[model samples]
Target: MKRNNWLSLLEGKYRVEIISLCVIIVIWGLLADFVVKELYKLPGPISVFYAFYKVREVIPLDIAVSLLHFSMGLAAGAVVGITIGGLMGWFRVIDRAIDPLIEIVRAIPPIAWIPFAIMWLKLTHYSAGFIVFLGAVFPILVNTYAGFRGVDKVYIDAAKVLGCDKGKDLIKYVAIPHSIPYTAAGTRIAIGIGWMCVVAAEMLGASNAGLGYRLWSRFYLLHMMDRLVAYMIIIGLIALIMDRIFRYFVEGKILKWKKGTVAV
Candidate 1:
């Protein structure tokens, strides 16, 4: 009876998800099989599955390289964004001095920096990471600034009464905690953008070995539509997995206080 109850619970929770996935797969399969008769255009699930086997030897390395680029960029972006954003938030003079420069730089698309990245850093992981950084840094900076700016004056006064007199101390204790949600939101956006930038960076000659590189150079150039589609699907799945993991940690652990609230 207990086992039956558990099974029912699982089914109830996942029924919609399961049904949606099945429906999507069925429609995709039908479209590939009937409407898109040409394999080059749409290769269906079976072809994509087989393509994974065809490129199984290199998928791990590609994934690792892509992740390396992602980590490098994200780490650097987060640090710089938070530091600068904190300073800007804590001081009006700093904000005025830096705001115009930041706005001008961020106006340029990350892809536009590829030439400079390759020229300055060469075809290396750092160059790829640089592109990812451009894609990620702005959102985090903006969101963190907004978060810090939104901190209540009452909280600052209370902190001051509690002996948090120094600017750094007040920011560390009062502002940082209040801004966590905003920072988290920015980081989430950065993750998606950074992931995409890493792929684009790799494809556009930032690195010689990555999912994007292989997908564009090996699969697409050779007209291996199945393999190309397979890589695309893999990229999407990895992004989805990353987002879910981040959400789990942030919502389940870091922001546990928000549970049972509308924000959760």
Candidate 2:
């Protein structure tokens, strides 16, 4: 009975994803080993694995630096974005006064700020964080604004009737709770943009050491295609892991009530 249950669990939960991943790996290995003999373009999985093992000593440091950059920027952006966005949504006058400036700044892509960041911050970890901040802030700000604005008028009225007449009280008890889902969605989008910005910022020499810097060094300085591919894979894996973690915390834990609202 236990063996049957284990088989059922594997088949129901893990079988498709495991099989698909294996198939992709097999196809990639085959193409790189036989069809694509051009080592400069695409190295085989074996070569990449070997390169990964060879560079294992430096990989942890690079990953740590990149994560630091990402974390700092994400925290800063979320704090400022949510505060300002909530205020703007609550106060029509504030929204009108700042809307034009927000739109103007948001129009510019985060990559375009790389030169300015380097100039202002002088090629440090802070510069990389700044770039990530630019990438992440807008999505969070916009979504927060939408979330606050979407709060039901009836809720506000009910709160006021219950002696929660102060704007702060109403917002604290009602607006924030209703906006949790929207805030989560915005945070997810910001995380993806922030990850891309971290790579771009590191590539542009915002930091002395990072996965992006190592990727560039392998490709340009050492001409190690296998190592370059290894770094690329590492970046993708890190991003995937971050997204999964964020979803698990926000959607699975904090927003458990949402589970009954949607059917999978």
Candidate 3:
């Protein structure tokens, strides 16, 4: 009975994802082994797995370095973005005064700032973190601003009627709660962008010890295509894990109230 129950639970919860992953692996293996005759162009699953095992010892250090860069940049960007965005949304005058400058800055691509970051901080962890921060901040700022602005006037009025007319009270009780979904969405986007930026920054010599550094070293210097593919797969797996962790904590637990509104 216990085994049956566990099997049913897996079928209900993870069936689609499991099937999709299997299909993707099968297709990838078939194409790499048969269709793509050029082994260097696309290594088969077996080659990639062998490479993974070969580099298993160094994986932890690379993962740690990359995670440190990602976490530092993401935390800083979230705090600054959310604060500025919240204030701008709450105050029309502030928004008007700051919007033009923000728009001008946002027009520049995050990667474009790499030169400036290198000049300012040199090719160090801080430079990499700065690049990741640039990648993460804008999406969070825009989404947070939009979320706060979209808060209904009716809710504000209700708060006022309940003697919560103070700005802080209204924002704390009404605006913040209403904007949680938007913030969560922004955070999700920020994480993806930040991860990409970390890799890019590392590739550009922002760090000497990271997954990106190893990936570039394997591809360019060592000419190890199989190990390069292994690094790429590891990066993807790390991102997937981070995304799932965020969703489980933020969406699944904090936003439990939203469950009733959607059909599972």
Please report the candidate that would top TM-score against the real structure.
1
TM-scores for candidates 1 onward, in order: 0.93, 0.92, 0.89
Clashes counted in candidate 1 amount to 0
Better of 2 and 3 by lDDT: 2
Pairs that collide in candidate 3 are none
Q: Judged by TM-score relative to the true structure, which candidate is superior, 1 or 2?
A: 1
Candidates arranged by lDDT, highest first: 1, 2, 3
lDDT of 2 by residue, 71-181 (tens): 999999999889888888888999999999999999999989988998999978899999899999888888889889998889988999999988889889988887777
Worst 10 residues of 3 by lDDT: 255-264
Clashing pairs in 1: none
Greater-TM-score candidate between 1 and 3: 1
- Each prediction's Cα lDDT score? 0.89, 0.87, 0.86
- Per-residue lDDT for 1-264 in model 3, tens only? 457864675577788887787789899999998899666888888888899999999999999999988988999999988988888998999999999999998888888888888889986788889988988988889888988999999999999999996899999999998887787788889999999999988887777778988898656477788889999989999999988888778867778877522111
RMSD of each: 2.8, 3.0, 3.4
Of the candidates numbered 2 and 3, which has the greater TM-score value? 2
Runs with alpha carbons beyond 4 Å of true place in candidate 3: 1-23, 260-264
